[model samples]
Target: MADLNTQHMIDEIRDNIQTGDTLKTKLVLAHLPDVDMKTQNRLIYELSRGDVRFTVPILLYLMTEHVSIVDELPVIKETLLSNLLAYPELLIEFLSDTSIKDKTHLINVAGELRFEEAVPALLYLVANSQDEPEIKLIIETLGLIGDPQAINTLTDYLYAANRDLIITAIQALGQVGTQSAMHRLAERMGTDNEMDYMILSIFADVQDPVSLEKLNDTLASHYAHMRIYAKQELVRIGAKAVPALIDNLLQDDPDFVIHTLNVLGDIGDESAIMPIRKLLGKDPKSANVRFAAYEALALLPLRKGAYTLTAGLTDPEDHVCVAAAKAIDQNYSEILTAGIKNLLRPKGDEARHIAKIIVSAQVDKIFLSLAAEDFFQELSLVYLPHAHKDTKEHYTRLLVKHGFDEFANKIQGGEDVKNLVKVVAVDDSRMILNIYKATLHELGFEPVLFEFPASAIEWLQNEKPAMVLTDLNMPEITGVMMAAEIRKKYSPKELPIIMVTTQNETNDNEAAYAAGVNKVIQKPFNAKSLKAAMDEFM
Candidate 1:
C-alpha cells in the first residue's frame, strides 16, 4: 500500500499528464521517490502515453535520477525511445525550446538511442543554434549516431567561425570514420597548424592507403610543426604505416627518403632496417640520407647497427659525425673499448678530428682524459695561428692547463665573428617593403627586398634565406604559387615561409596554406605581431 503523500503525488502526475500541464507534471514527478514501486510503474505507464511535452521531461528525469521506474519497467524504456522516434516533430519542438538545458538532454537522448530518423532535426538545431555549448552537443550527437547523411553538414562545421565548434566537429568526424569523412579531413589537412594534430589523429584512425599517403606527404610539409605532427601520427599508426612508408622510400626524392627514414626510426621496428640500409648503401652521395639511416639504425637493437654508427663517425659532415658519436655513447657503450682506439689511431685529418669528438663524449674517465689531451693538442696546432685575441687567450689557458706551454706562448687573437640571419621580404607595394626592411633591421636581421615575385623566386634559387615573407596578391606570381615552387626544392625545416595578405577570405587563406605557406599574417600588422610571427619560425 502507498503512503497518503505518495499516492497523492502519483494522482497529481496522472492528472497533469492528461491535461498536458508540463510544470505540474514535473512537480509531481520530482517527488517520485516518495511513491511505492507499484504506483511508480503506474505513473510511468500513464506518462508514456501522454503528450511528449509531458513525457520527455519525465523520461529525462527518470533516466537522470536513476529512478527504478526506468530500470524495473521495460515498457518505460521502450516507450521513451519509441516516443522520440515516433514523434520526430516533438523533438524539433523541444530543440527549439528556449531552455538550453532541455535541448541538451533531448539531443543526448536521441543520440543515445541512435535514432536515425531524428538526424534531420538534430542537424537543423546545429545549423541554427548560436550557442556554442548547444552546437557542440548537437554535432557530437550526430557523430554518435554515425549516419552517412551527417558527413557533409559536419564537414561544413569544420570551417565554423568558432574554433571550438570546428574542433568538436573534427572529433565527431573521426568517430564517424567513414570513407567520405576521412577524405574530407584529408582534403583539409595543412589548413591550420593548431588543428593538424587532431586531424592527423583522425587520419591515423582511418588507416587506409589514401590516409597513409597523406601522412607521408605531411612528413615533408613546409612547417616543422606539421611535419612533427605527421611523424607522430605515423609512429602512432605503427606497423600500419610501415608498408606505405617503405613504398615511398623507393622514390628518388631525397626529402621523402630522409623523412621516411626518420619515421621508420621513430617506429623502431626491425623490419625497416633492411630497406633503410639498402637505400643508404645506394645513396653514398647523400650525406643527409646517410645521416638519417645511421640515426635510424641506432634506434634498433641489431648488432650491425653499432658498426654502421661507427662508420658514420668517419663521415665528413660534422652533424653526422656528432650524431654517430652520441649514438655510440648512449646506445652502444660496449663499442667504446675497441672502437674508440680504432677511431683514435692516426688515419687522416678528418678521421683524427672525428676520433677526438668521439673520445670526448665517452663515459669512461680514462678514455675521456686521454682523448681531451689529444684533442687540445690538435686544436692548438690547427687554430692557434688564426685564432682571435680572446680565442687565442682561451686556447692558451687550455694548452697551459694541459702542460703545453710552448704552444701556449704562440697564441694570438683575432676579431669575434657575428653570424646574421638573412630574411627575404617581397611585396608589390614599396611602402610595405620599406616597413618590412625597417622592422627586420631593427630586429637584428638582414633583409633582402624584392618588389617583384619572379625576381624573389630567382634570388631564392641562388641564395637560401633563413625565412621568406611575401604578400599574397602579387603581380606575375602570387605568393602561394611562388611558395609552392620554392617548396619543391626546400623542405619546411630547411626554409620557412610566411604570407601577408589583406584578403580575409577563407578560400584564399586555405589556398595559401595548401601551397606551403607556413603562417599567414593579415594586413596592417605591426612590428610586434610581425616580429612574433618571424620569431615563431626562426
Candidate 2:
C-alpha cells in the first residue's frame, strides 16, 4: 500500500480539496506517502488553513519519523499557527530535534501555543547550553509553557554562575512557580549575594507550609530584611491555613482563632467541619465563626454530614440558616421532595420555605464523582429529620469521625460555585447541571450555558469562554468528538477545553487529551477541586 500511491491520487486529492470535495480529498490523503517531506509540506501548506483533515496524517507522520520537518516549520509558523494552533506533540518534535536550524523559532512557536509538554525539553536545553541569546529565548519559552514540571529545574538554575542565566531562570520561575516553588525561593531569602535581588523578587510570591515553617523558625533573626519577608509569606498563605495555622480552636490566640476560622472557611476543608459546627452552636452569635462555618459547609461536597447543617436551617444566624437552606436545595432537593409524602400529616414550614428559596436559585450542572453520587443516593433513601437535637449532634460528630466532614460542610454551605473564575459548564444530567450552574452563579460568574456541543460551539464562537466544561456521555456529540471539533474549528490558544466524566481509565484520558482536551476533571468534583483545576490558568 505504501508503494501503491499513484501520483494521480495526490493530484486528484489536491484538486478535489481546492474545489471543496471533502470525501474525495480524504480518500486521496489516506493513500499518499506522507513521509515524502516536500510532497507533505506542499499538501499541508495548501490545506493549512483548510479543515482539520491535514492534521491527522501530518501529526501521525511526525510522531513516527521522530525528526523535525525543519524546512516546513517556517511555513507552519507563518501559515498554520496564525490560523490554527498546531498540536503540542508536533511542536515538541520540532523543539526537541537538535537539527532544527531555528531553535528560537521553535521556542517562539511553543510559547505562543502554551505547549506545557515541551517544557522538559526546553529546560534541558537551557540548563545545558551556554549560548546567551538562545538561553534567553529558552528561558522565555519556559515561562510561557508554565508547567509545574519546569518549576524545579528552573529554580535550581537560579543559582547558576552565569548572572544572565540566573536572572532568566528566576524570571521564568516567577512566571510559572507554584506554592512549593515559591517556598524554595523564599528559603534563600537573606543570603546577600548577587542572586539576592532575584530571591527577594521571588519572596513576594512564595507562600506555603515549608516556607512558613522556615520563616517561623527564623523569626528571631536580627536582620530586618528577613523579618519583612517572613511576615509577607504568612499573609500570602491567607485564610486557607486556619486549622494548620492555629494550635487548637478552643484555646488558640484570638487573632489565630479569627484567622483560622476565616482560613478554614476560605480553604473549605471538611476536617474543620465539626469544630466549625461546634463553634456555630456554642457562640451562635460569633459572626466570624458562624460565617466561617457556613463558608466551610458551602465549600464542602454535600453529603450525610450536611444533615447537621440542614437541621440548623432555623439557626438564629441569618447566614447559617440561609446556607443550610441552600445546602438542602443543592444536595437534597430531590430527596426532600420525595420524603414529603412519608412525613407525618403536617410538614414543617421552615424546611418548606428553605427548600423553596433553594429551588428559586439556579443550580449548576456538571459531571459527578463516585463518592458524590453515593452521597446523593443516601440522601434519597432516609431523609427524615430526627426529632432529637442530640441526634443531629451525634450524626454530625459521626460524620466528622468518618471523614465525611468535607461533604457535610459543603452541604451546609450550599453548593459551592467558586470555579466561576474562568469556566463554562455543559452537561446532560438535569441535576448535576443544575448543581454546577448554581455553584457558578454563587461564585459570581455568568457562565455560558449549553446542553449540547452544537449549542456549545455556537456560544463559543460568539462569547469565546476562557474554558469549556463538558460531560463524556451525551445524546448528540460525545465529549471526545466535541473536543476534537472545538480544536479543529476554533483556536485552542483562544479557549482551553476541559472534559469531565465518570470514566477513569487511562486510555480514556489519553484519548481525551489526544482529541485536544487540555485538562480532564473526573466526575463528582467538589467545588474546591474544580476551583483548583480552574486556578491553573492564573
Candidate 3:
C-alpha cells in the first residue's frame, strides 16, 4: 500500500475506492507525475464514472501541453460536459489558461457537450485580453453550440469601444454567419464610418438588398478608400453588381467615375466596353480618370481597343505612359521585354533604381521573380533587428529564398546568446507565471520561481542569477520593493535587474529605477524585445 501513495494520486484515486479519503486523494494527485500516460488514461475513466474535485489540475496540465485525449472522448463528454453545466468555475479555469493549444478540440467538446453555461466565460475571454488567439475560434464554437443566449454578448462586442476588437468580433460574427448576424452587419454598413472596406467584405457574403444600396451609395462618398472598397466588393459580386457600377459611371463625381471604371475592369464584363469606350474622350486631362478607362479597355476579352493603348505610349504624363505600358504588357510579352531593355540600357544610378522598381512591377514572370528577391533583400537590410520577431522570420525567409543563404545562416546562428541569458518573471496570473517558466525552458535557462517577496529574498541569499526579469504588481510586496531589497543584499557589480509588468504604474518605473533595476520590459512583450533585453544583462 506504500506504493499507493507513491504512485500518482490519479492512480491512487482509482485504487483507493474503499478508503474514500478525498484530501489524501487531492494531496497525492498534486504531487504525482503530472504527465504519466497510463495514469492519465485511468484518471479519464475515473472522472467519467464519478465526480472528482481534482479535475482542474488534470485539465490544466493536459491543456498546457496540448495533449489530445482522443481516447478519453467519452470521459470528456461525461465529466467535463456535466461539470461545465453544473459548475462554471471549471470552465473558467480551463478557458483562462492561455497555454492551452487543444483549443479546437476543446471547442468541439464544448459544442458536443452543449455547454451553454460557458458562453459568459467565452465572451469574457473575447472581450478581455489581447493575449489569446483562440478567442476568435472559440466565438465561432459558441455559435455552433447553438446557444441563442450568446447573441447579445457577441453583438455588444461587435460594436465595441475598441476598434481592433470590433474588427475581430465582426470577423467572428461572419464565421458564425447567422441571419441576425447578417442583419446586424448590414446595419453597421449603413452607419459605421471608415469601415467601408469591412462592410463591403461582409456584404459580399450577405445577400441583403439594403447592404447592396449602401455599398453603391458609398461609391460616390468623399472617401477614396470607400470608393476602392465598393469597387472591390462590386467586382466580387460580379454580374449582380454590373447595373449599379454602370449607373455610377454615368454620374459626374470623379471618385464615382474612377471607381466604377476600376470595377468594370476587375469584373471583366463585356457589357461595360461601350460605356468604358465613351469615357476616354470626356476627360483626357485627368490621368486618374483616363488610366481607369484604359485599364478597363484592356480587360475586354475581344481586345478591340489595342491601338488606343499602343498610341498612348507617347503621352507626356509619366503615369499615363506607365499605364499604357502595363496595359500593353498584359497582351504582348515582347513589349515588356523591349521596355525593360530600353530602361536598363546605359541608365544612370537614378535610372537604375527606377528601373528596379519598374522591372519589379513588370508582367514578365522571371524578371518579376528577380525583382521580388531584390525588393525583399532591400527590405531586410532596412528593417533587420528593428522589426518584431514575427516579421524577422519573414525577413530572414526572404534572404534565404534569394541567393543570400549564408546571410540567413548567420542570422539563425546570431541569437545563440539565449543560452548565456536568463529571465525572471514574477506575476500573479498563473498563466503568465507559467508562460515565464516555459519561455525559460525554451531559451535553455535555469529559471527560479517565487510567488512572494520572502521566497524571492530566500533565493537571492543563496544563488547568483544572470539577471532578473520581474513583474510589477505582485501581492504582499511590489516588484520595486523586491528590487530595493535585492540591491541592498547583493553587490553593485553583480547581475542586472530587469522588471516586466503589464501595468505602467508610472510610479513603479520611477521607483524601480530609484531602486537600481538595470532595465524594465513592459508586458505584451514580443519575444525579440524580451531576448534583446536579456542579452543586455548577459
Candidate 3 lDDT over 1-538, as tens digits, reads 3345324555567654435655554454443344455665565567444443445434434444433453333444455556555765566566656655354455556665667767766776656645445655666566566565666666776676667656766665665556666566656654464564676676677646655666777666543335446666777788787776777776776546766776788788888877776676564555556656766665666355544454445444434444554666565554544544444444454334433323222323323333334443343333234322333455467656766676555434324233444445565444344445535544667556666666777787787777777766554556777888889877535968888754344555687888888887765443456678887757
Model 2 scores a C-alpha lDDT of 0.55
**Worst 10 contiguous positions by lDDT, candidate 1:** 359-368
Each model's backbone clash number: 4, 26, 1
* Candidate 2 TM-score, true structure as reference: 0.31
Identify the runs in model 3 with alpha carbons over 4 angstroms from their true place: 1-24, 34-37, 51-108, 111-152, 162-164, 178-200, 204-217, 250-254, 273-298, 301-538
Q: Quote the positional error of residue 63 for candidate 3 in Å.
A: 5.6
lDDT of 1 by residue, 1-538 (tens): 2445766776787788778887787767665566677776777777877877668766766675655645666666677778887886677677666653446668887788777878988888888777888888989998898898999999998988989889888888887887788888877767786688788877777787777877888776655556556877898889888888888778776656777887898798888877877776675566566666766766766646555556667776544565466556545544554565565555567655664444233323223343345544464345344433333455466657767676566554333345668899998655456456545655767778999988988888889999999877554467877899999888888899999765444656787888888999765555577899988888
lDDT sort, best first = 1, 3, 2
| lDDT (Cα, tens digit) per residue for candidate 2, span 1-538 | 5665556665676677667776566555554344465665665566564544444333333323423553444554455454335455766666666655456656777788887778877887877777878888887788777787887777776676777877777677767757766665665455554455455535444544554455443333334234334344444555544444444467433323443444454455566666766765675445434544554556556556554554545554433444454444455544444343233113355444333323322212111211244434234213213112222344345456656666444333223333445467887544455546544554455556677778877766666666788876554466777888788666566677777765454655786888888888765554566677766753
Cα deviation in Å at residue 130, candidate 2?
2.3
> Candidate 3: global Cα-lDDT?
0.57
Most accurate candidate by TM-score? 1
The predicted structure with the larger lDDT, 2 or 3, is 3
| Candidate 1: residue 513 lDDT (0-100) | 83
